[model samples]
Target: MTAPQCPVAHEVFDQQYMRDPYGTYASLHEKGPVHRIMTPEGFPAWLVTGFEETRDALADRRLVRSIEYAGEDYRTLPLPAEFSTKTVATEDGAEHMRLRKFMNKSFAIKRVRALRKRVVELTDGYIDAMGESGETDLMTAIALPLPITITGDIMGVPDEDRANFQYWTDSMLGINTEVVREAGATMLGFLKRLIDDKRTNPGDDIFSDWIAWTDDDGKHLDDHELIGLGFMVLLGGYDTTVGMIGGGMLALLNDRPKLERLRANPEQIPDAVEELLRLYGTAHTGVRRFATEDMTIGGVDIKKGDVVLCSMGAADRDPARFENPDEVDLDRPNLTHIAFGQGPHYCPGSELGRMEIAIAIETLLRRLPNLELAAPADSVQWREAYLIRAPKAIPIRY
Candidate 1:
């Protein structure tokens, strides 16, 4: 089938859109669920906006995550070879399931639930360091370090090595291409060494488990696959959780009534966490997928090999699927937002992320009864990245 005539491409991920994307998403939804759009990097892709369409596109087997299916014109984030091989995010079908199976146990509900006391301990320690805070950047003081430390803890990275890992991870994800390349190489080398050590000296951590694990058929991930999985875990576990905690906290601090309600009824924090995720959830865009065959999503025709971006941020706030989609209603019955995405590639660490966020928020509300934004809400700066959504910093007073 031939490609359909495209509409004028809207530059939807520009600086202005980064500041606030929901308005643009609402505008796109009003016209249609899918639209031709230009990414910040100047590549054209189809953007799925409506909640139903976004969810359907995520689950559609016709759309695949492997770059091999992408047309020559499709552009993807640049990654070192070590970072690209055998990752669950880049695989499909049986291979994806196999790769994911190795990680499922570590992030299982029981395992995540077991992590609650440790999460609380870490959170309390961070809050205690704030020392009855007068003012501080929450991102630095808690949001950034908490998740990174937890990731290091779970991966069995030595305490002395965490700072280096954190530096490399931040540089690799930053806007500087040169820094990204250099940091990717450094991080790869570090991961290789870490894996080598884990093989010889296993410990009670995920990395050690992965090193020792083999399926019923006596198969296991090779060094390259282990390296890639290690990189993916570091990125996925650290950045997104940081965003969720920081963004969710910022959202709650701005709404005193909701904050107080959560503080008063700590039990409601779990449900309230769902509402925060719906309103301020990160993972602004889903993994980029290439259409494997001609298909239609939300009445918009997609050509084979075309790039498609499903906007979780847009989908979660879609009015057709959610009443008062923009507002935070803790009582909202339909909490089925695709914040963690859907289908085969759904986030494996979702339970861990949810527990981290819930514990972080609950502890903050309980301890810092007067927590509020130190600076004007509108003055807060947002980090401008194509795939993630989070503030640069959240200044707070308690």
Candidate 2:
């Protein structure tokens, strides 16, 4: 009889980890740079801990990021075939490159820089709204909507459809419930129509650019590919920036001095953004890569088809790379965290995300100098889903 599998890891639930995964991350890293574990939802996975090793493993081509690479037995995992084929996140090798290349032109940092003024204006509006409320749940009221609005703005999603996009993103990023799945269908349909509209009547927005985009080979995005890319971007753009603004707010509020520091020296906020990203940084829960060939990363013997889950949260706290890995230091140098997965999958939207978040925080301080958390930190409700982590509600008083 086969013995029960004892995967080497610190078994953790999503809620517990979501609430405070740090101590667990620290404890797990002690076992080795790479830890084999099961998630709260009973998913078999490995979490990479050391920063360098984590970065290297993310780039390892042998570990294909999709259900298909795991072969027939992977059917036990319950992934739909359409999901396996349609999304760039699930593609590897030439496919990943092809999908990413079509997007590169529209997502350049220059394009992000061009959107700065509009982002600032949106930030101003959110702040204005928050001021009227006097006390507000920063996550929902400001942090959340800023990125959603920005993404809609970039993609040129109609105003009527923007909030529904946020709802779909929340579902996709968190638990894949019926709400998420149904909303996803609606969103996909909408993007397909949007892409068609762009094809017929093109505009300057990134979505329009994507709809008309071609790679080096003169290939364009198919409908399914376009839908997948647009879906991924909405979640990616909204969540990372939302986390940055909301999570960064929490981190800064934890220190009145940090709050005042940014107010006094706005220049410090840029570095503060990096430090915030390092600490409360996101894009944390990402896809599981199945090894295409037997290989070792971070000194672990990864068998062919073994699933490796990349946890930026654990990697960001690697003590070997960052002194007092758990602490957030605005002045830390040579800091590179996996907030965006490194290598080929490095987030294409980093510039726009950072700019929107920084401007939000900067504007928040400027507009509401007297802001403080309305509730204690522990009272904040966090997201419990496996794929992404954030507070469900973050209340603050001005």
Candidate 3:
């Protein structure tokens, strides 16, 4: 395909857009499936908002995840050597498959199912500690701690070190460069110690399994791969699940009628969870992919090395793909949303994420029938991250 001159970039990441991204997406969708937009970081990229376009772009092999393919103008955070290893998100083709295959076993359906009882126990325990709640921040009380603890257990992080582990994770996500670098180094050191311990004394955890796993050719993950994979799993499962839980609960609590329906018939909680993900999945955009060659998406000419961001947040709620796209419909006929993304790069931890959200919501509905927002819905604050969509905190009374 022949490439055309890039279109004028649309400015769409301002405060208004962050506050009501769905509204911003709706406006973008009305304009076209794909758009040339200036990211908050002051770089030009294509934002695919149409459901079909986003789905097709996600599965498109020509759009790759590696930073090497990026245009010179594309900017990204600098990582230290210890944190620069190729991970599932950074590799493509066979290497990606190899990494994904190894990680998949840890989150397989049966294994995730086995953790259901434990998830319920943890959820109940956290809520119990809330002391029947007068008013509390749901993010700390349940959303953040639950996933942190669960993913911590999976990584075999000792109970005493979990607080420090959480701190490192939070610091790594902060905006300060020095803090991020320091946190990355500290976290890498901690993970290396944990890996060494697992090697000497294996356990029923993902890290130990990665340490023991050998491919058909008797090849094992090298030190770099092991650390990279461990870091990815630990961070990936924590922030995204926390966002989903907090966002999903906010969606329910905002809608009294639908919330009541689920409470009346707890069996429908799974379906409600799907709808919640469709509307409020934390991954606002798929990982940035650079075009390997000139291509056309939704009629927009994308040149080689141009950065492309498939907006799952926009696509899943596209009115054309979904009827009444803005509202949640638990009985919605088609639940196959691209919130977890699509194709080979689709989220490996999807089953585990679904299980966690379902269990958390179900437990909340059953235990706290009177749960309500402590403040007006509009007063709730949302995190100002371009890649992630979640509330900064959810104040509630039960």
**Residue 346 alpha-carbon offset, candidate 2, angstroms:** 0.5
- Model 1: per-residue Cα lDDT over 239-320, one tens digit each: 8888999999988888889889889999999888888888777888887899999899887788899999999999999988
Q: Give the Cα lDDT of each candidate.
A: 0.84, 0.75, 0.85
Q: Could you arrange the candidates by TM-score from highest to lowest?
A: 1, 3, 2
Question: Over the full model, what C-alpha lDDT does candidate 1 score relative to the true structure?
Answer: 0.84
**Which residue runs of candidate 1 sit more than 4 Å off their true CA positions?**
1-10, 164-171, 174-176
Question: lDDT, candidate 3, residue 65?
Answer: 88
After superposing candidate 3 on the true structure, give the runs of residues whose Cα lies further than 4 Å from its correct spot. 1-10, 81-84, 164-176
lDDT value for model 3? 0.85
Residues 5-100 of candidate 3 have per-residue lDDT tens digits of: 234444477777777788788888788888887776567899898999899999999999888899988977555554554788888998888888
What tens-digit string does per-residue lDDT give for candidate 2 at 55-120?
888887777886666743342332233344657777877888888876676688787898899888
Quantify how close model 2 is to the true structure by its C-alpha RMSD in Å: 3.1
Candidate number that wins on TM-score, 2 or 3: 3
Candidates sorted by lDDT, best first: 3, 1, 2
Which parts of model 2 have CA positions greater than 4 angstroms off? 1-10, 40-43, 71-83, 175-180
Model 3 TM-score, all chains together: 0.94
Q: Flag the better candidate by TM-score, 1 or 3.
A: 1
Query: Which residue pairs show collisions in model 2?
Result: none
